[model samples]
Target: MTSARRWASVAAMLFALLLAATVIPDGQVFACTPTRVWDGDGPIWCREGMHVRLAGIAAREMDGSCRPGQPCPEASALAARDALVNLLGGAQGRTSTGHILVDGPTMRCLSTGNARGNRTGAWCAAPSFGDLSCAMIRTGTVLRWDRYAHGRCRSR
Candidate 1:
């Protein structure tokens, strides 16, 4: 084969390898169990699978208007709570043991794992009221929740 063609082939192989590594690598993989299911905003929940898009949500939160001290507005919190409840309907009361892709500032809720309801109503941060810019996630979609802790949910 011509030298130029060989180099092109090698480059293509390397790119393919890189892509595979990003998707799945030799490491721990957790299967998420979505006891509850919601079609509203926030991270999507699945019946059984791990979450993978934590970074993307975190990035959006950082870039959004919500600041560190300021929790999500009331409306946002209610919406999230409603969505969560809708998902949790008829399921066990205890919060499911699984990693959730959440915004860094909103990480407090995930960390607490409180099933009492919305952040303000419970112990987590409250959602922004009347503000639709709240962190929104696709419901029911599953991804790798924790990447570094060997199938364990990462703490914020």
Candidate 2:
């Protein structure tokens, strides 16, 4: 009887640990796979078409004009889209699946990149590139979300 009771106690502890593992979330990487990407606002069609705002950045639509006082050529938004496609290695293959790691409004990730620093700033990263939002900022395709970014981004 004593041996049987000890075995049961061990089993209960194991079960509790398993339950905790399932309930606790991964805090570091909010990851996903996307099938389509939107031109404006840098959202993607992923996790079954969830609206995923690209954590800490914003972009113009493919047909929208550049921001006022910004000297840019016509259809700059289209160029931005193409730049994104190229950056993601042709969009369909790279952005389509298994490359996007999102932790923000779309994924309900409570603790994503700089999230500790700024509550609203979640982040998305790929296997190769470190941070997608920062990359776009560096390439002049997008700007940091001003409230969270402070003055982190500058023009190319």
Give the Cα lDDT of each candidate.
Answer: 0.31, 0.49
Clash count, predicted structure 1: 21
Q: What digit string (tens of lDDT, one per residue) describes model 2 on residues 1-156?
A: 698999999999997655323311225444444445555335444453333455555666555755563334333665556555555555444344334333222232322332221122335566555566676666776666666554544455
Clashes of each: 21, 0
Number of the top TM-score candidate: 2
Q: After superposition, how far is residue 39 of candidate 2 from its true place, in Å?
A: 1.4
Misplaced by over 4 Å in model 1 are: 1-33, 36-40, 52-79, 87-91, 96-156
Q: What does the lDDT read for residue 97 in candidate 1?
A: 46
lDDT of 1 by residue, 83-130 (tens): 444433323443454323232212222222221222111111223311
**What TM-score against the true fold does each predicted structure earn?**
0.23, 0.50
Off by over 4 Å in 2: 1-29, 47-49, 65-75, 93-121, 150-156
